[model samples]
Target chain A: MNTLKDKATFKQAFIDTLPVMSGYLIMGAGFGMVMNSYGYPPYLSTLMAVCIYAGAMQYVGANLLFTGVSLFSVALTTFIVNARHIFYGLTMLEQYKKAGKEKPYLYFGLTDETYTLLSRPLSVKNKRAYRFYVTILNHSYWIAGCTLGALLGSAFPQVRGADFALTALFVVALVQSLEFHKRNDLPALIGAGATLLSLLIFGKDNFLLPAMGVIVALLLLLPEKEAKA
Target chain B: MTTHTYLAIAMIALVTALLRFLPALLFSRMERTPRFVIRLGQDLPKAALGMLVVYCLKDLDFTSLQGYLPATVACVLAVFSYATKKSSLFSVLLSTIAYMLIMNLFF
Candidate 1:
């Protein structure tokens, strides 16, 4: 038994995830409160938290739900919002290949936080249990927060401007990505410019797909060295 | 939940799960994928984050300082706070609380 791996138990997983516990609970509660303020039920909140476990999309979803947007819009926008998970899955393909019975749920729950936690290099005896428990615990924390927030929201509705947290969260993500890739802001710049251009042409409600299309076309056009770099 | 609502939730879940599932299924099964596709995946995330940041701010009245006051201030605060404090929780909490106060007091 390697001492380094630490036998990744539920206790270890729980301890490892303590930081995420605070983060998830607060964010989840915020999402729940927003949904509740939109007059969504508690069950709906938990159900979304369980199924559509992507935090950013779920946060954006409250707006979608409130507006009662078209199903096509919901499907298309969500694909773009959570599209980064494709990269995550690319890296995780080998590791998750070992997920076996837990594979489907593993893929379903591979939210950003879970991807970060699971992708850490951990030498373990049973990698499956380690990954599985962490995934389950994280999902449960989110569900708990969402459910509580929905209940509170159902009790007292009118909490406007709380959705600003969504913008804040997006900024944090953008900054984090920017800081990580200091020299290569070209792609990022292209994305922003392309999106704004598309939005101007297509209008906000119909701009997402076109914006993503432009981003993809431009990204693919980058030289191999520049793109990979 | 209404039947319509349930359908929306289910559709999102199914679509999102499929997004995560496709690469795992495709790359593992196929012997060759285009170099450009892999490169795009490598580079897309940072760019996508940038796109999303713009998308979030797109609705704001960015043409003037006053029309976009609270949101602009909060976004700048969030970015700067994150730079110094290096804590997402603090940045998010501070900017959000600051935005709420500014909106109520001034806006």
Candidate 2:
């Protein structure tokens, strides 16, 4: 039956989300450790992860929460900081349209990792089914990691420095992006330059938004040679 | 804990989810999206990522700069290694270990 096939496809999609889940576990655990160190209960941290599901933003939120920052300020910051998700959603419109009933879940599941996985030209029987499966699978992984971290926070008090893992992951992602594009350091240069300029001009707290704004503006305005496969 | 903290967390989560989920849900219903929306999507992710990288490195103090210097070197080394068609894992591992050693020695 069609329903049976859909179930099977969804199961496979979950299976395909394993890689992303692994990454999320490590990062989420790091977040848990940091939150515990800051005297927040692990359950709170886990809840934040489950609900917000934005990694860096959650980390930033934890700090802001500790300081008793206003909700308005946090909301404003998140909008400015994550404004890029708007673009991410835009790019996926065409792909997501063909997703049918699986569309809602696909939209919710589209994290950076999921996006990367979906964007790749991988083998799949049903692209929409696989996409939805991958998205749900990745979300489950993140939620699982967050819950595990919360439970482990108290018993294993001294969580080591795991923040570096995120940086390492990004470094790996940058390398992969480079390899994918066959480019010679342009992306890295732009990233570093924008970051440095933003830091100098905007201070630590506000640098990211303006820097990103500059980079996106520049990339959009400048014309590039068409990519050749 | 104050009620304000709890409320703040809830609000943050709500806003984030709305931004993330609404567009995908609403836009998919339409047969055709406007040109501006399409253009916005194309440019947004990279810009956001650029911002995130800056956000992470924003707290780099001069004193800690020395600690991160080796990481910078490792990044360059990794790029060259990648250029030579080496495995990405190998390049990242090599640089990470190098960074750790340098950090331990200096800091």
Candidate 3:
């Protein structure tokens, strides 16, 4: 493949990702631990880290797999959970179009952290290499963290309540979503209401899909807000 | 892992990658992103993430204090920590510990 030989860009990329490294390692390990606690293999967690790199979705996906949830629900949940990436891709279209050989990977590896880092103007001589290295470094930190957590989980399989990490994760996301998105109140209310209603109606074993349906239906019917300049 | 599980993971990965890739592929040739998609992108996440929070708490038993108290306290802690510190790691870590302690000690 294309060898990115610029050490300067790589160094800059590495430094930029140091914060993400700590977060990814801890979060990825938590994902791995959760999966391992459910009796899945470490390789499975590693595979997820490689294939599906989204942290929130990985935790959700592991729960789905463990529960033997239907494939349709899996796809639907993934789409809803990851829908934000569409906007991220929209914003990056111009930059990635010129990415050449790295276009596909750069697109695939565009997690939230990588996208945030790349959105900033870079001082490196090779912007392309910087972009690629940033993506690669963030990805590697995630994989390493997953592997490390899976091994640790296996060593101490008695660790109860690790699965609560999933709840904490979604909680953090919900908090951040509310914090940043000023107009998020109505939609958030619709979401919680629809989900609680579904759970009560459909019971514990199967409420997610219907809850998602109601949320989507309700949100779509609402008038679109005026576009910002 | 079972083949079914692998299939499910593949589906998740495919959909996620496609979501990230489709905008670039479709919109590169278009003048501007469709208003419908843009609106959905902004509004859907808030709703979906809120749904996820409720989904996570679905199993909490309301009839008994033990079943629901820990989760309630932990969730409140999570929200408070994230709102104040804005550190996802610290919030998640702190709330999870609080959850484990409550679950082990009381319920």
What is each model's TM-score for chain A?
A: 0.67, 0.72, 0.68
Off by over 4 Å in 3: A1-45, A52-142, A149-153, A157-159, A162-166, A179-184, A204-206, A226-229, B1-16, B19-28, B63-66, B81-90
Error of 2 at A10 (Å): 9.4
lDDT of 3 by residue, A1-229 (tens): 2357788778878876765675677778888889988999899999999999898799999999989888999999998777757645755666666677888898899786677566433557788788889999999999998998998974533445655766776677766666444454677778889999988998876676778778777877887665751
Q: Give the Cα-based TM-score of candidate 3 against the true structure.
A: 0.61
Query: Poorest 10 consecutive residues of model 2 chain A by lDDT?
Result: A157-166
Please, what is the whole-model Cα lDDT of each candidate in the order they appear? 0.74, 0.63, 0.78
For model 1, the superposed segments whose C-alpha errors exceed 4 Å read A1-41, A54-103, A110-138, A154-163, A179-183, A226-229, B1-9, B31-34, B62-67, B82-90
- lDDT, candidate 1, residue A92? 67
User: What lDDT does candidate 1 reach at residue A75?
Assistant: 95
Higher-DockQ candidate among 1 and 2?
1
User: Each prediction's interface RMSD?
Assistant: 4.3, 4.0, 5.6
Show model 2 residue runs off by greater than 4 Å: A1-23, A37-41, A64-69, A116-126, A154-162, A179-195, A224-229, B1-3, B22-30, B36-62, B85-107
How far residue A38's Cα lies from its native spot in candidate 1, in Å, is 8.8
Docking class of 3: acceptable
Ranking by TM-score: 2, 1, 3
Model 1 lDDT tens row, A55-158: 87898888887777788888988887777576567656667765567787887777766765665455556667778878888899889878887888645444
DockQ of 2: 0.36
Please give each candidate's TM-score: 0.68, 0.73, 0.61
Model 3 Cα displacement at A73 (Å)?
12
Best-performing candidate as measured by DockQ: 1
Give the per-residue lDDT digits (tens) of candidate 3, residues B34-99: 766566656666676677678768778889998789889988999898878987668877887888
